[model samples]
Structure formats: C-alpha cells, structure tokens
Target: MGIKIVPRHGKSLKDKLYLPAIAGGMKTTFTHFVKNLKDTSNLKTMSYPEVQPEDLSERYRGVHRLTKWDDGSEKCVACYMCATACPANCIFIDAEERFDGVAEKRPKQFKIDLLECVYCGYCVEACPCDAIRMDTGIFSFTGSSREEFVVDKEYLMSNERSKDLNDG
Candidate 1:
C-alpha cells in the first residue's frame, strides 16, 4: 500500500470537534457580554448595601440564638444536648449552676463558631428547654479574624434583644 497526498482545503476531524466547542464557549461569553453591555437590563448584580435581603420573622430559622427568659435571665440550662446534636461541633458550652436555684445550670461560656456551623438546625431541635434556637434572624455575619467569628453568648443574647426590640 502507498500513502496518498491530499489537498489541505479544509479542517481536520479533530478541528471539527474542537472548533464547535470553542465557538459554543465564545457564543456563551459573547451572549453574556452583550447582555451586560445593555444598561437597560444591567444583568450584573444588585446594588448591594443599598439592596440587602429582608429580615426573617420570629418563626423563621436563621443563625443560632440563645434566648433569655422574661425576667432578663438566660434560659439555657446547658445540658449539652445542643452541643451533642451539632453536626459541625460549632456549639461550645460550659455549664454552671445558677444562684436562682430554679434554673439548675446556665452556660458559663457558650460560643458558636459560625465558620464551622453547617446551619443544619440540629442544635435548635435538640434543645429540650427551648434555650437554643435559630429564630433570631440576624443571619448576616462576616469576620476578618477567628476571634471575631467565635460569637460568644453575649453577642447572641444581645442579638436576640435587638430583634425583639425591632419586632416590638
């Protein structure tokens, strides 16, 4: 058998497969580019800061919250149920008996690392006394440091009060 010389008039089979793919990718990019070029549509993004998401209601589930009682006292007994149920191990609690005597235990140092929290709501479900919950609705959180991300009980408790004030 002898090799035959053919004229280079067209693209090869490899080019046929890859050219269409390149064309499709370019078409997609161009389509988006054109859409963005039209200021009437503004197909980029929201104005941000000026256009933030709305607040969640009392019933709405958001970031984890530790609620205090009507008498301006912490409701958490810190039974470790919430910590045990937390899939991400975000909830950290140190229980100590209260002087009030009625409430056996309160969280001495309750901290939840939002970075590690999966927001699965298991901690909320595991609370027997309804102390820990995801109802505060202050979901927007960002931190530059690990210390900032580790939200202690004070911040969470104050957040609940702020929400209460807003709702009222």
Candidate 2:
C-alpha cells in the first residue's frame, strides 16, 4: 500500500488573521480589569507584606523542619529515608553512631537545598521516626546567596512550627 494524501482545507480570512482571537482575549482582559477596578476585592490576590493570610491549610507543604523529642533530642534516626524519598534529591545526610540511648544513629550533618526542593512532603512521609516535617507554614523565604538557601541541620532543627498552623 502507498501513503494516502489527505486533502487540506484552506483557512478562512478570519482564521488567517488572528485579530479576532486577539480582540477576544483583549475583551476578556478588559472586562476583568474593569471588574477588578470597580471591586478590588474581586481579585484573588493578597496585599503581601502589609497583610498576611489569616491561616494556611493543615496540609500546606511549606519549608522543611527537623523535629525534636520532648527532652530536646533530635528525632531523626539518620536512616537516609528522607534523602532516598526526596524526588528532587535536595536532602543530604551524614550519619554518625550515637552512643546516647536516645537513638541508634544520628545525623552528623543534614542539609536540605531549599532552592532545589520542590516542597513535596515525601521526605516527611518517608521518615519512620517522624523526624522531618514540612509544616512550618513558612512559604516565603529570602536569601542573598545560594548558601543561605541550603539549610544545615542546625537551621532545620531550629526552625519552629508556626503557631497559626495546627500543631498536630
């Protein structure tokens, strides 16, 4: 069998010229602009810095944080589960044997590259010891340098959970 030649239909002058499509888009934009001008509240945007969201959802995945036990001991077992589960491969852990009875293995160093992290909760879910969590409710983070965004163990451990978010 030979290749079949399909008949092609020529586009209409209206289709050839994208002016109508552009005009429709412009019209929609103008309508929304006029509506927003009349009612500023209708726009789905918050006046950031001046106003913050009242509350974030319970499952809102924000920055990552390493949890601690009641005695102020780290909860991480240094199993590398978080690192393994991280899709972005942002988590890096160096394990050290812990002589203290608190846990078998503790992280000598744990670093998470916030810039590389996709804000996915896989790391939190992968931790069997309930060590890591992304519930700090800190969606906005700033840094002058790339190193500032790569948080170390101390930084992750020091990050406190937002009071506005549910502790549980």
Pairs with backbone N, CA or C atoms under 3 Å apart (clashes), candidate 2: none
TM-score of 1: 0.75
The residue ranges of model 1 lying beyond 4 angstroms of the native Cα positions read 1-23, 42-44, 54-60, 161-168
What lDDT does model 2 reach?
A: 0.89
lDDT (tens digit, per residue) of candidate 2 on 18-45:
8888999999999988988999876788
Per-residue accuracy of model 1 over 18-130 as CA lDDT, tens digit each? 88779899999998788778765656466865675555455655677678888878888889999999899988899887899758778899999998988888888888988
Highest lDDT against the true fold, candidate: 2
In angstroms, give how far residue 11 of model 2 lies from its true place: 1.4
